[model samples]
Every structure is written in structure tokens, then in C-alpha cells.
Target: MTIVVVFIIVLIPAGMVFFFHHQNKLKLRARLMREAVRNHEFTFHLPVKGLFYGEKALQEALNDLGQDINKLVAQKEVESWQKLTRVLTHEIMNVSTPIQSISQAYLEHPKVVGTSLEKGVRAINDAAGNLVTFVDSYRKLTQLQEPVISTLRLKDFLEGIMELYHNITWEIGIPADTVLDTDGSLLRQVIVNIIKNAAEAGAKNIECTWRDSALRISNDGTPIPAEVRRDIFIPFYTTKSTGTGIGLALSRQIMTMLGGLLELSEKADAGYHATFILKFEQ
Candidate 1:
């Protein structure tokens, strides 16, 4: 009788403790989900360390849900942006083409000749050219396709890109011995975009280095403001007065597709550094 009573008492309290712990964990997870939603962040996984019963199963379920929601959101956003780009480009081209044609006709008209009219035509032509360039940059953003990856020599590929930026001196620290398997053209685009931005930011000297499967590009220029750095990779976010703000976003997309990451870090003393981490293929 004594033994039976003791066993019952122990089992009952033990079970209660276990149940309470599980319930608390579930509550914590629910709180995290709510917080994530409030912050406009996609929450796809439960808290890493605070998981309750069936941790693996819950994680898998949450991951699936998160991915599905993210996919749907991205699809809708892309469709909307594409439609906007098409409409805007068409409308702008329509306006620009007629102005260009009229300006040329007026400039060449023998019946009408004046210095003021000639100056007006030149101004119209210059404005049209600027608009065309702006539209072209947006077109590039919307029409990016997936890259084709292959084994490529890192040194040669980087040198080819640096050669294009002839105005700025490049200090390369890449190992000639290292080779990488990646999308050569896409990688080149990423590097070019960074270097181009650096040049715009008053960077006279640019340094490119590769170490431990990571590529770091540093430039001696004005440091990017902390507020702008947070959203530098976001679509339509630009620090430049005339920037289209899609280059960094596209580069990040390409890197993500290639199982890599693009990150920015402020230099301790001066300038800023952007790093691309390429995962080695298994």
C-alpha cells in the first residue's frame, strides 16, 4: 500500500512538469510567430533553441509554410512590377520618339531658321537621351535571366572585368592558384556593379581580394551611411541622386541562386567593403 501511494504521487507530479514545459514552449513559439508577422518578416522556422515536442517535425512544417508564403508573395510582386515596367516603358518611348522626330524635323526645316530654335532642338535631344538611358536601366532590371555556371579561372575572369574600368586603378589580391566553379558572367556583373558604385562614390583606388572562397571588394571612398546600408540591396533603394537602385538587388538575387551570400561591412578606419561568399560545390 505504501509503495503504491509513493509511485502514484511521483508519476503525477512528473507528468505535470513535463506537460507544463511543453505548453510553455508552444507559447514561446506562438509569440515569436506573432512578432515576426508584425515586423513584416517571413517566419519560416520555429525558434531554434526553444522548440517543444517533435522539434524536427515542427521545424519542417514551419519551413514549408514559410516558403510557400514567400513564393506566393514574390510571384505577385514580380508580376506587378513587370506589368508596371512594360506600361511605363511603352508610354515613355511613345512620348520620347515623337519629340525626337519633331526636334530633328525642326532642326532640318529650311523654311524655319533661328539660333533659339536650334538650341531648343539640341536641348530636346539631350533630354530624350537621358530619359532613354533611364528606361534602359530599368529594362535591364526586369529582364535578368538565370546564369549558366561552369568551372572558371578566378584571376583571369576578374582581370577581364577590371580592364573595363580603365579610369580607376585596381589593386587585386586574388590568388592566381585559386579556381572557382560558378556563373562566370554573373560573377563578373556583380564585381562590375560594385566597382562602378565605388567609382561614383569618389573612390580613386579599388581593391579586390579573394580568400577562403570569399571575394572581398573594398574601395577608398566615403563610407555608406548606416541607415542606407541596411536597405542597400532592396529593390528601388538608392543612395545616388540618379541611381536606378536595382543593380545590388540583382546581384544579391544571383548570389542567392548560386548558393552564396553578399554582405556589406563598414571599414573600421574608413571606406566600406562588400564581400561575396561562394559556397564550394559538394
Candidate 2:
């Protein structure tokens, strides 16, 4: 009986020690996982204590944690974008309204129909037209609606877009059989904004091509400065004297909403190239 009692005592303590050690290991693993998430590494790890709770329960916990982190990051990004858009829209509209009203008034004045007044009216018209255009562009950036998707022939759609900028010289290289599923209006706007930027940059030769689900537009104009290129998609960031700087921003937002992406690259020669990748729906 004494031997049995001693054996029981030894076994009990050993079991307790093992239990605590296992728990300590689990705690350490959980800590490591949290650290990895904080560092933006999304690698998944099995919970050390998972065996106690069952694999399904442990997986659920990890999934919930991951979702929470993603939601926080996404919320922060959206908040920042909203703030920037609001500030830009407010500043642009302030300038646009006065210019439009004054221009209309000058043009409508009976006494100002002829003489130097006509010249003044014309000048005001030009300024107001530019302001109106800027305001329109800014609105596009700040107020994006959910895209309406449809299947479209890539060649036909691109050809139509090219027609709008027919005055500008262009060289297009795209497969005639390429087809894409996307929002037609939004895609057109993206094309127009990029083409307009190329024209404004004094592009004498604009080249467009499509491959690997991406459409690339290259313009042989002055290269975009590295510093400016970084912030090109930012709302109200512009290099032009008359630019409202919302065109590229709007285009980026549209593409993002459509589950696509827009990127800018520089050529070794001269000028900039903009690429838009349309992700295929799974």
C-alpha cells in the first residue's frame, strides 16, 4: 500500500508539470502569431491549444481574428480617401462656381455683345469652360458609383475610345479577339483620362497595346518626374497649371471598384506609360 501511494504521488506531480508546460508553449505560440499579424504578415498558424478545443473551433478563432484585422485596415484606408476627396472637391467648386456665373453674365449682357466687351466675354468663356471641365473631373473622382458589369469585345470598345482622341496621333496594337468583362462606362472613363493626360503631356506618338489581361497606353512626351509620379493618383495632385488633378484619381477609384488596377511606368526613352489590368471574374 505504501509503495502504491508513493507511485501515485510521483505520477500526479509529473502530470501537473506536463500540463503547465504544454500551456506555456501554447501561450508563446499565440503571442508569436499576434506579432506576425501586427507586422502585416498574414501567415496562418495552428493554435497550440487547438487540440483541447478541437480543430474546427481553433480555426474559427483564427479566422475571426484575421477578419477583424482586415476590417480595421480597410476602414482606415477608406476614411483617409474620403477626407482627401472632400477637401479637393470643396476647393475646386469654390473656384468653378464664380467663374461660370461671371462668364455667363458677360456673354448675356446686351451692351457687351460687341466691341472690347466681346473679347472680354470670349476670355471669360474660355476660363469658365476650363473651370467647368475641372469641376466635372473633380466630381467624377469624388462621386463614384458602383459599376454595372457586362461582357464587351475589347477591340471594339478600344476603337471607340480611340475615336474620341482622333486628333492625337496614336499607334494601337491589340489582339482583335480579346474580350473583357467589365463596366463599359467606367472603363471608357479610364481610357479617356489616360489619353487626355498623354495629350496634355505633348505626346506626338501614343502607343496602346493589350496583353495578359492588361491594356497599356504609352505616350512619347516628357517623362513624369519620379516625385510627381508617386502622388499622381492622389486627389488634387497635379503638375499642370490648369489641371484639377482629379482625372487619374477618379480613374484609379473606378478601376478599383471594378476589381481592376491602374499603374504607371516610365520608359527609358522619353514619356510615361500607364497600364490598366482588368481582373477576370472567377
Candidate 3:
């Protein structure tokens, strides 16, 4: 009886010590997570090492939460920029239309005709005309019509695009019977825009197929730079000197309007510099 009592006393104190240590560890992890989220570090990760099975589950959940937060933050940023673009484009259109008209009148005036002022007026006219045209391109981004969804035949759809671009070698691996319910016209526009951008980037080979429950188009050309990835969807952000930078942003907006997603795959397969994924609503 005496020996049993002694054993119980020692074991009880040891168990309590471990319990407190484990509790403190969990508390620390939670505190750190809150701090990370507060600082907008949504990519933070916590390892599930030396944890109780139940605690390991909690850790896994927390890790997934961080990834979810990161996605939500990205979506919000895109939405905020899209809203700002709409407002800015509206204002620009309102102002540039009058400027373009006034410049045209100045160029046609007899007093300015065939003189140095004509050259200057012509410059203003051209500038205003180009500005109006550029703003017109952005109108598609803000004024997207409601999608009329239809059953899209994958093979036929891609074949049409393939026939149009002969310079770039195309390898399409999607099954023949694979059908998608989407807005066919809008979807076509998005794919065409992406292909044109890739062609301009010097892509010699382009491949499109289905992967991970989505359509993935990958190209062997200039990879998107890391610096450009973050702002790739922002309106008017372009790498090319003549690029209006409306393609991807407009594509993303179209997909969003269609209850789908269009995104750049960060880690592309070997031999491919860039990959884009299109996931439709299920």
C-alpha cells in the first residue's frame, strides 16, 4: 500500500507537468497564428511535429486556413483593383471624348492648316484619338454582358483556335467527348486572348489539356517574371511596350462573371515557362 501511494504521487506530478507543457505549446501556436494573420502573413505555416493526434489535426487545419486566407486576400485584391479600374476608365472616357473632338476641330481649322500650329494640333489630335481608343479597349472590362451559357464542345472549340494559329505548334490532349457548360463566345474570347499573348511572348509550342479538374494551357516561351506575377491581373500592368495589359485582367473578369476561375499556375511542368488554368463552375 505504501509503495503504491508513492508511485501514484510521482506519476500524478509528472502527468500534470506534461499536461501544462502541452497546453502552453498549443497556446503559443495559436498566439503566433493570430499575430501572423494580423500582419497579413497569410503564407505562414506551422509544422505538426511531436503533437498529439488530435492536436496534429488542429495544426493541419490551421495550415489550410493560412492557404485559404492567402487565396481570399488575392481575390479581394483583384476585386478592389477591378472596381478602381472601372471608375477610372469611366472618368477617362468622359474626359477624353471631348478632348479628342476638340483636337480634331483644331486640326481642321483653316487658321491652323498647313502651318507649324497644324503639326502641333495634329499631335494633340493623334494623342487624344489614341487615348480614346485605348479607353475603349478597357470598356470591355467594365461593361461585360451577362453570359449566355451553353454546352461547349471542347474538341471543336480548340480546333477552331488551332486552325487560326499556324505558326505556333499546338498539342491538345483533351478527350474528344469532353464537354463543358459555359458561355461559349466569352470563353472563346478569353482563350484567344491568352493564346495571342503567348504568341507575342515568342511561344513556339503551346499545349492545352485538362488537369486536376480544370483546363490547363501551358506554353514553352518566355516565363512570366516573378515580379510581374503579383500584378499580372492588375489593369494596365503590362510588360510589353505596346501591350495594353487588358487581356489577362479581362479574361479573369470574364471567368469570374461566368462563375469560373482563370489563374496562372505558379509551378508549371518542366519545359513550360507559363501555364494558365481555367476552372468552370460545377
Candidate 4:
């Protein structure tokens, strides 16, 4: 009876310890998993044998989700590019077809060496030349050079850029020692386009800020209307009388090529009506 009593006492304490240890192991594994997914380490490796059944099941689900997300993103990008090409083709043919017909008619016309028609034909030729130049500029969208990336100090870059727009007031909120890995020249072009548009829209104040590797540029200009917002990112889409419609589109393409994103945010702060955000990959 004494031996049985002793064994019971020993087994109870050992069982409690075992229970607590197993619980803690599960807790630790769950914590690590949450951290990995939050940090975007979706490809993190885990031993198949050491984990409990639940952990193994979770790992398999995550792997499947990651693959599905990648496939969807790739498919969407291809569709977007295809739509952009169709718009470009339409724009090109519209100009080229008329130019070809007009020039050919001028050549075949029996209106001898010089007359009033000669002046009209010369004007048409000059206009066609200008349209060709415009199309050539648009082609640069597809020909963007790969970025030469480097670590850049944000405050200094903004301060220098601020020098270019002396007429507009600046409200800079970038944190000190904030740095980013990006292509300086290419990023500058993107910023320039945004800032230029803000100034053109009659914005008296522009705010530049950053958080969590995302840069925000807010302006005191009128907010873009809801209907126009959806089409703003489409290549060759614009509302301004003189707008080429390529600036924002080119900026977005550059950001995509750098594995980042450029987008317009609907939210606004007091006194500012429009905002453009650029998010970078970690």
C-alpha cells in the first residue's frame, strides 16, 4: 500500500510538469508562426516532425495561401498591361491614319509647284511631325531603364527638392535619420511629377511625410472627384486641357518595376484635400 501511495504522489507531480511543458511548447510555436507571417516571411521553414498536428496543418494552409496570392497578382498584372497596350494602339492609329491619308492626298493633288493649298499642306506636315514627336515621348513609358538603387537619406533629398519650387510653401514632416533603399534619380522623377501637378492645381501648401517605409505627399488643392479617381491611373487618361496623361501612369509603372507601389489615398487631413502615397517593399 505504501509503495502504491509513493508512486501515485510521484506520478501526479510528473504529469503536471509534462502538461505545462507541452502547453508552453505549443504557445511558443504559435507565437513564432504569427511573427513569421506578420513579417511577410511566408516562406519560413519549419520541421514537419517537431510540430504538433495543429501547427503542421497551419503551415500547410499558409503555403497554399502564399502560392495562391502570387498567382493572382501575376494574373492581374498581365491583364492590366494588356489593357494599357490596347489604349496605346488606339491612340497611335488615330493619329497615324489621318497623317498618312492627308500627306498622300497632298502628293497626288495636281495643284502645281506652289499655291494656297501648298501652305495648307505644309501646315499639315508640320502638325503631323509634332504628333510624331508626342508619340515618341509616350514610348518612353515602356523603355524605362532599370533603376540604380542605393540607400538615400530622406530629409536631405526633400530639402534639395524643395529648392526647385520656391513659389510654393512646404510642410515637411520626414523623421531624421529616416533612410530608404531606392533609386534616387527615378524616385525624384516620380516626386517631381506629383509636386508639379499639385502646384498646377493651385495648391499653396504641400506636405511631405513618411511612415513605415511609405512616403506621403499631401496637397491643399481640390480633391479629385470620385468619378475621375478610378480612371486616373489608366495610361493616357486625364482631365486637364493640356495634360499628357502619362505622368502619373509612368510614375506607377516605375514604382511597380521597383517592387513597390504608388497610389492615391482617399483620406485627407485638415486643410489638405489630396494625398499621394508611395509604399516600398521591405
Taken over the whole model, the C-alpha lDDT of each candidate is 0.70, 0.70, 0.84, 0.77
| C-alpha RMSD by candidate, in order | 6.4, 10.5, 5.5, 9.3
| Residue lDDT tens for model 3, 1-282 | 999999999999999999999999989998998998887666566889989899899899989787666656656766876688778888987888888899889888898888889888788878878988887888777788889988888878998989989999998989999899888889988999989989988999999998645788999888888877867888888989988888888888887777767778767766799999887655
Which candidate number has the best TM-score? 3
Q: How close is candidate 1 to the true structure, as a TM-score?
A: 0.62
- Look at candidate 2 and give me any clashing residue pairs: none
Local error of candidate 2 at 94, Å? 11
lDDT of 2 by residue, 26-57 (tens): 67767877886876634343544435667458
State the number of backbone clashes in model 2.
0
Question: If ranked by TM-score, best first, what sequence of candidates would result?
Answer: 3, 4, 1, 2
Candidate 2 vs. true structure, TM-score: 0.54
lDDT of 2 at 146: 81
Candidate that scores best on lDDT = 3
Q: Any runs in candidate 1 off by more than 4 Å, and if so which? A: 1-11, 47-53, 110-114, 151-182, 191-236, 252-282
Q: Where does candidate 1 clash, by residue pair?
A: none
Give each model a TM-score: 0.62, 0.54, 0.75, 0.66
The better-scoring model by TM-score among 1 and 3 is 3
